[model samples]
Target: MSAGLLILFYLGLSLGPLILAWAQELDPRTPWDELATGLGFLALAIILVEFLLLGRFRLVTGRVGSDVVMRSHQLLARAALVLAVLHPFFYISPRTPAPAWDVTRQSVVDQSWHALWPGIVAWLLLGGLVAMALAKEVSGLRYQHWRLLHGLGAAVIAGFGVLHALRAGRYSADPALAAVWLALLALALGALAYVYLIAPLLRLRRPWRVREVRHEADRTWVLTLTPDFRGRLPYRAGQFAWLNVGKPVVSLDENPFSIASAPSAGPEIEFLIKEQGDSTCRTGQIAPGTRAWLEAPHGHLIIDKHPDAAGIALVAGGVGLAPLMGILRELHATGDQRPTALIYGNRHAGQIAYGPELERLAREHGTELVHVLSEPPPGWTGETGLITPDLLRRHFGPPDRHGWLYVLCGPPPMLTMVEDTLIDMGIPAHRILSEQFVYD
Candidate 1:
């Protein structure tokens, strides 16, 4: 789907509730009461739609990159929290049941303790959920444990929010509005079920086995995996997968890593992983033949979609080179004649992965390879310091700006700086694809 269409679809879903409620044409309440109702409807809709954003649905993430999807999920969650918190405060109406003289209840908001409890619970839990997400990095919770808690907490909040709307909302008495609320709730919970349960059940039939784990660069390892079955994963170059090495099929222990091996390179897959803390501490030490499961082929960093581009510029930082390697390999395997350049950045020479293979690509495929090191050793001939605008200007000048696709992967700071530089060079935003390391 196109970006415009995807955005319109989202706005339609999130705002549809308020539009429908306004169509009810009941007696208008005080401005503050109506404002409260409208905000509540928007909050509920936004919260419900968040499920699809993180649901790993290709239709959503395919057009928008996974990083975009994740960032949207985080930003929208905060907005929903703000709207939800302020939902009740704007009501100027009395707290009373619908009186016989006022069937529309325009003068009173739902005041029954039983009906109000759900909203109270949801309001408090929503605050906690957002706080947990904001503090995810410093929470001292394992990624998997944090993921489980996040998922369960979101599900509970959605249920309570929908219940409160149905039982207490003035416009919700309209069957149309109530049905939309229930349907949205079903989709929200159903998405959660599919991610945690249905997807795992399906994965059970297609397991993978760890083939090898070889040290690649400083503190980085190249882990190879081959499917235990006959079929290979249908994935595009520059995409990633969730790896669950030595973990259960339904386990949340899986971590996402960009696929380092091209789909053209047989059935085996490889991941260039940096040894971070926690589960990744065992990354370089995993024994071969370990049982593994992969929830794969996510991310929209693929280059094939831009066949019309004049050239390709791949920018990488450290292990971020993994996905770009997949793209370059696929191009080489397919004998793509388009001119391509790779600007790989790292802190030091030892941090660079796939040095020999990249050189081979430069020799055989005519790929322009440039390495940038922050802490270069003596007599270094390549660019020194971080990837600078001057460096990008020399490479992606206006002369080659016929929408040459620039794909980037790295730490958030590097991606941001490089992306801003690219746009400053008059490269249309659509021409760039990026996926950053999501610390959450």
Candidate 2:
């Protein structure tokens, strides 16, 4: 459906101008001014429809419609470029006694190939905009910089396209085309305003207040936030949320953090934070009652929907144990005894963030806990070295079971290695769920 709609939009965008131009030449008393008015209406409708479908506010489940809208806009933009290039050629009259291309005696408009330079630039920028969208996820670029570039590109394309059309005075030959151009310019500006100004401002209105801050071993801090809203944050146990500190206008940078606490029956939320990089290093100073913002509840690693599974395998490394804590706590709370097995890895036993709590939960819930350490002192027991395939096989049985789920979370390389090992050990791809904290 999305592909077909995009094709229809492309066809309409390509033929709109040509059909309007031809309708005028067909009737001597055709009131070309009326045709121009209609052209304006058509352009207005086209741009308005694009915004209505592709605008930022709409949320389709799992970003399904959003992806479709993006692809549709890209196709239309490309078609617009082709039409823009051909528009001048089609309108130039062969018998108008206009001179052949000349360099010196030409007016400024004719000197620049009928002002095609501006349209050419506009087309290039529009193409760049589409390419940028395609590379957004792959490039791992900063969001603020990407947003600014996207906005600037949109402004340049819309602004230059309008200037190109009006400067030629060809659109003035049809009032509708002129009106269409006006509406298109306004639509483009409106989109930018909504994205840059309104959305960010709204995210500021209701913020989370830090309720408590507890420092665990190894410089890990657990931040509990009480959302201003009265209900619990609608997030799954393994999902993460974007947290904002500082005001909307100035400190607009927010980092995504995994929620450490279970989906509690309360209004408070919690995040298990590791002080690794720049934004997180300052987490020590995040005092109680400090205001923060949240945008959230993403990821597909939760165990909520898989109630009938025979068992679950939870693999965690370092602070990646946070979400696993939520899962275990929820299972304990709900009195679930589904033979859950946890394989936690750390450099040393001292670096485990939720060591004590996990031990207690394991004892109470009858869930087996296996610890893997990279470096252990003399006489140290339990499994050692990385969570390699040999260790997994020695601990758990063969991975070809039908009713088991595997959840893994950690740094990228470690997770990749473990995931590959599991696949090689015969685990089904769909049975394994993974999460990565680092964002592009």
Separate clash counts for every candidate: 0, 5
lDDT per residue as tens, model 2, 1-440? 34456557545654565466555553322243334323433333343334434324334212322334455555654554444444444332222323555322122223254555665677567667767866987767776567568667767776776666555444334687666567657766886676556666776655788898888757788888988765667887776776786546334376667777778645677788988756788888878888788766755567876776778888898888888777877777777778788999888867878778878878887778998889976787888998887887676665434467888888878788878877877777767777766532
TM-score of 1: 0.97
Q: Model 2, stretches more than 4 Å misplaced? A: 1-196, 249-251, 399-402
Q: Specify the highest-TM-score model's number.
A: 1
Clashing pairs in 2: 36-175, 36-176, 37-176, 40-176, 40-180
lDDT of each: 0.90, 0.65
On lDDT, the candidate that comes out on top is 1
| lDDT for predicted candidate 2 compared with the true structure | 0.65
lDDT of 1 by residue, 39-135 (tens): 9999999999999999388888888888888889999999999999998999888886778999888788888987799999999999999999989
Model 2: lDDT of residue 289: 80
